[model samples]
Target chain A: MKDVILGIDIGGTNTKFGFLDRDGISLVQGELSTNEGETVHDFLRVLYQEVMTKFKKIEDEANLIGVGVGAPNGNYYTGTIENAPNLKWHGSVPLVDLLKQYFKMPVFLTNDANAAAIGEMVYGGAKNMNNFVVITLGTGLGSGIVVNGQLVYGHDGNAGEIGHTLVNVNGRGRMCGCGRKGCLETYVSATGIKRTVYKLLADSTDYSELRSVSFNDLTAEMITQAAKRGDKIAIDAFEYTGKVLGMKLADTVAHLSPEAIFLFGGLVRAEEFLFDPVRYHMEKNLLHIFKGKVKILPSGLGLNNTAVMGAAALAWNEMERGATA
Target chain B: MKDVILGIDIGGTNTKFGFLDRDGISLVQGELSTNEGETVHDFLRVLYQEVMTKFKKIEDEANLIGVGVGAPNGNYYTGTIENAPNLKWHGSVPLVDLLKQYFKMPVFLTNDANAAAIGEMVYGGAKNMNNFVVITLGTGLGSGIVVNGQLVYGHDGNAGEIGHTLVNVNGRGRMCGCGRKGCLETYVSATGIKRTVYKLLADSTDYSELRSVSFNDLTAEMITQAAKRGDKIAIDAFEYTGKVLGMKLADTVAHLSPEAIFLFGGLVRAEEFLFDPVRYHMEKNLLHIFKGKVKILPSGLGLNNTAVMGAAALAWNEMERGATA
Candidate 1:
């Protein structure tokens, strides 16, 4: 009989699930639209039914070991999802209790970014690293810090909010969704890049591509395309974004001194265009003592499957901890 | 015979030596001028001569287990002092090699900030904490980060350079002694606060008792006194410094998520004048998850003797590690 673990990645729009073995090979992958407007109980019922039906053929052959879940605002210590802004859930939801009724197995839950970090540690580029940071550059910047071979959850499971760190105190007036001003997320995220484009357009008289595109319609893909075609304005925007990220990274390095910072998500797909500038500026800003160290690498796991793998890795980590004890 | 550990705190101006038992008691304490301008051999000769003469009466009665030295830029990984800017030293000075000639015992060395953190962990406020940050707001804003009960030393032994972290990107053009602009040390340290007062005098019409003091004569002590006397400008200076510190601390909290941050140095002696504003602004700037959970505590160690005690504790930590290994 084969033993399998259930990995669940919960998002605001959709939820992804996978059945995996010890080697991280997925036997079955599935997704379902997350009707966050519905009650938590109703959403769970539908999810459970779908999962049970999908695994019915292999239920007898495969022994289920545990379940791991990655969700927004998930607290590893309390096993609850706190007031997640994107979800309909208003307060702390006891996810462990709800999952226990369905799985009758050991379950683990952590914030999505942290799960991604664990994934990187177990199955990705950070396999040999003792200290590193995983940065997800999406609509907002999300970070997961790994210190001394373990994720830093702090006393209240609120560690690794590096995106909210102030990069510029008075450079921009764009308010972060977190109610903070001039945060790193305000200048480096996908939304932040668009704002940068608008600012650059306003500051420079360059015209070629993206001049006609409204600020609301500007996307990261368009910017990448423009840069590939050698648009100086687009190139400048990327350079500006990377410069801000690098300077902020220098400050982070001064504090924690991680071995590397792993870039993930859509913005990272630009690769050399974004990474070269980030690395160049970071090295320039770094202190003499910390020079020529700390690599900035891209996430090894594919974007579609990384979250699910990370979620599964969380369960595996807990299972190993239980065995060690 | 009672067992004692010799603790040595090496400063640019003076060197303090003390003998401590496991119970955190100081048996004998002495001080000597560090004449760093002299050759390394001469400096050690004087240090050893003083130690032998001072403790000769009870030398045979007490068994010395080890020696610990703390200096401006001491490295734990390699028992050497690397080009401390405050001292007249030029290159890497192997302090352990010189000390070993005098005493055939175990010796450990670390920078002053790391030594203080170990002191707090072993004998002071952070005795029970597995994670914490000790900030020394002296000539510079030195920081020591403890994660999961161990000090975080990066690729090089220069991990905790929190002073170099930029706090104000555009607030002022004051260049840091580190050759950087707007570093946290440029606004929070004793030197930093003086710079702030000077800037305030030049920019603002706010008048106080501080106006009469020249830039060379202006000190953090004077600012504290003026704040105590309800001087608005002095109070505003503290407020401004705290605001920058608190905002940066929020980012720090997000990175490591320590249980508390221990503040030390002459500036911290202002107590409520500094701490209240720091606390207020730290809370205001912190993410909701960490708003009231973490603490900002004043150092419990006496300023007069903390340096020696901290250096001793560093030796104690090394001894404990050796014993376990």
Candidate 2:
């Protein structure tokens, strides 16, 4: 039988799983609701069954060799997800141990952002790069830093929490779910721009379509559409968001000195609306030696099953490392 | 023959060179003036001759295996010193190639901070650590970031320039030697604190011994002595310095998430004056998950030939990697 690995992305709303061959073919794929209020055990049990049912069709052609997982707070060292806010489960979830018992295969796990970073290295723009960063912009901002071709897991399993880092040390009253003020996520994420929209409406008399929308009704998509239509408020919001992100990226450059930074997820769909500002401000803020040297590029994975691809890459990397060792 | 590495530290004023056996002994040592006004050729010729003379005694006991160099703006990828303002040399100098002709052995070079980082990992507190940062608090704040047991060289071999990162986005006129305003070095270095003393004197009327001293005459030592004598301005200077350093370190933690940070050079000698504030503020500013996790420690090597030890470690690490590969 051909060797294949199982890739799982444990998202809050839905869980996606697929079997990826060594050549990167998705032999089989399946999905199941996470069931927000249900026990993690119940969810995993259902997910396992669903995934296996799909895997059965290709059983004769492919052998599932190992499992790779990506979750909100997945820890590679402990193989647990701890305090992931969006997930249904409270406290730490030992999903890896539970899955290993059912699958009887080698298992590995890491945070969602780190999974994306490994994905970039294994199957994306950073294939030959030894140092780069992957910044994923979604409901919240997430970052994965790779130095010398190795993921920076830090002393703790939780190393890449750039989203929660403060942009305004003495910020005026903006708080995050992480209970911090002036977090980068508060200023740069999808949720952040909505908040910026409300703040702009309150402070300015400028007429804009966003002023008609309620805070709860407003979505990142609406803002993108408005910006595309040349609404002044929407345009300004994107510019401000990119400014904060570029400044933080400049800090990342100073600290890690990566060859490039990859921008992924929803906001990247804005294309030049976001990329132009990020490049201009980042280069403006970069140290003289690093000026015009680092590239800020689009994520090659796009929006299609990045989490699943990331998980698969993680598994492939670990399996390859094990064999080489 | 017993294998040993030669370590060299090229400073603007003085250059230190020493040989180390595999057992970590400083077998032989020598020094020479860099003589900035003269051509690099003349300086290297005299320096190589002086180093060779010192190596003569140990030549019988230990075989010269390799050479490691630490200098301002030293690039490991190209093994050159490029555009270091502190040195009288105005442009890039191919120091490694010039030295290689004299020694005819493998040579490696990296910036002073990176050398210090390797020294910490190979010979100091971080020997067991795979991720840590070394900040040398001397003439200007210099940093070396180590992730996954490897030094980050970035795209251009200039990854860890943390000193140049801006502390104040809209900071009031604090220009650095690097020609940037609000640079962390402008507020955290020895020269920075001296400048702070002058600023404090200009802003406050509190009578202190510093008012009696000229800018050229005033020193960090005198300030420390004054603080010991209950001088308010001197005490405030240390506090303000630590606050800036700690706040910046909090940002460092958010970005890299290293196990610990090692502080080296002159200002670290102040000990509690710097440590207490750094610890207090670093923990306060850190994200909830990393609040008490990261440690700020004094450099284990201190002033006892750390530069030599660091350069030696770089050479030894390279030699070992070459052997294993």
Candidate 3:
């Protein structure tokens, strides 16, 4: 039987899972509603039933070796998901411990962004890179910093919180869901771009496709489409978003000096609209030594199943470490 | 004979050297003028001669096992001092290779701030800490970030350049030696504090002891003394400096999330005149999860020979790594 590891990516809406071999080749894939059950235990029970049903069908073909999970606010050190705003769970959820109750193998967990970083290292462009950063620009901005080939969990297992860093120290810029004002995520994420488009519409008298769209109904894709049609306000929104992201990225580069920075997630679909200004402003603001050195590139992982692959890579990395240790 | 490590700290003005046992106890210490020699080779030759004379006196009692050197712009990976602005050396000097020729033992070279971080890990208050940061606030601000018990040398061996991170993204701010404007170092270092005093003097009309001091004659100590005596401009300078430092530190915390940030070097002597405001503003700006968690503490290494101890710690750390490898 072929050895396989189970990889699970938990989200606020849907939960995706897949089984992969050591090579990161997928064997089976599936999904379920994260909001299905009332409690975490109830949710795990449903998840266990679904996994067992799937495992039985593949048991004769592939032998499950271990499991890895990527979720919002997942802590690699504690194996818990703490205070994740998007999830239905209330407090710190012992994800690893709960998963262990159903799976008779070693289990590992980290935030999705960190999992993506490990995926980059183990199977993607960063396979040869010892240090790099992976930024997930979804509805919110998330980051994972790698140095010396190891993920920095910090002292509290929650080190990669770049989204929470302030953008405007003095102004009441934007209200962050974290109950703070002017967070970097407030101006850089997919939601942030929508927010930007609305602000631009209000600020300028120039005609644009976005003028008719209401904030509650508008989406990032609408803005992207408008920008493609040469909508001035939409284009300005992307520019402003990139400018903010680039300035913060310059600060990030000063601290980590990573070989490259990988941009991943839905907002990355905007492509040049986002990358161009980010690259320009980042270079314009970079310290002399770091200039023309750090690469800002698209994620190497295929967009379709990147999160699942990342979770699998985390499992593989841990197994390799266990073998070596 | 007791085995010892020869530690050397190269400064713009003086080069200090010391012999330290594995326990970090100093056996012998001496210094020589850094500007005495015409070339780097001449400087090394004199340093070697001075080291030999000192070694000859202790030959029967102690044995030198290895050497560690800390200098401005030192690169751990390249083992070179690359275009140190403060040093007389004009190019990348292969310091480790040069030292290896004279010392028949292993040698290592890294920036002084990194050495100080290793010193904190091996011998100071952070002995148990696996993740921490050391900020050197001398004429310029320098930082060394540690994660998972290893210093973050980055891909280029120059990861920690927190000082160069921008403070003011717009408006012509303080000019930096790095050809950048509004860098964090321009507002937080010893010279930064002095500059702040001058700016305060210019911005405010209140009478103060610093009003008479010229820019060339102003020192950080004079500012501290004046602040102690309740000089308005001097006190304001310290407060402004702390606010700037604390704000930048909050950003630093977002990236690394180190257990503690240790303040070192000349400006640290200001004590509460600096620490109080830094603590206040850092807390005020820290992200919710990180608040009340990261400690901002004074360096545990004694001011008299901190650099020497740091360099020696680097040698010891490398030796231990070599043994394990």
- Alpha-carbon interface RMSD for all candidates, in angstroms: 1.5, 1.1, 0.9
How close to the true structure is residue A245 of candidate 3, measured as C-alpha lDDT?
91
As a TM-score, model 3 comes out at 0.98
lDDT of each: 0.84, 0.86, 0.89
List model 1 lDDT by residue over A99-140, tens digit each: 888888888899889999998988889888888889988878
Please list, in the order the candidates appear, how each scores on TM-score for chain B only: 0.95, 0.95, 0.97
Question: What does candidate 1's lDDT look like per residue over B60-173, in tens digits?
Answer: 778889998999989877889998997776799999888998989898888999989989988899988988999998878888888878888764677888988877553355
| Cα RMSD, model 3 | 1.6
Instruction: Point to the candidate with the largest lDDT.
Output: 3
Better of 2 and 3 by TM-score: 3
DockQ of 3: 0.83
> lDDT tens digits, residues A1-325, model 3?
9999899999999998898998888888889999988999998898888887888888999989889899999999889999999998989898998888888789999999999999898878799998999999888998999999999889998898888888877545799888878899999998999888878878889998777777888988888888888888888999999999998899999888999999988877888999999999899889888899999999988678989889989999989888311
Interface RMSD for candidate 1 relative to the native interface: 1.5
Off by over 4 Å in 1: A1-4, A53-63, A170-172, A202-205, A208-218, A321-325, B1-3, B52-63, B97-105, B170-172, B204-214, B229-233, B321-325
Of candidate 2 chain B, the 10-residue stretch with the lowest lDDT total is B164-173
- DockQ values per model: 0.61, 0.78, 0.83
Every model: Cα RMSD to truth: 2.9, 1.9, 1.6
Ranking by TM-score: 3, 2, 1
Top DockQ hit: 3
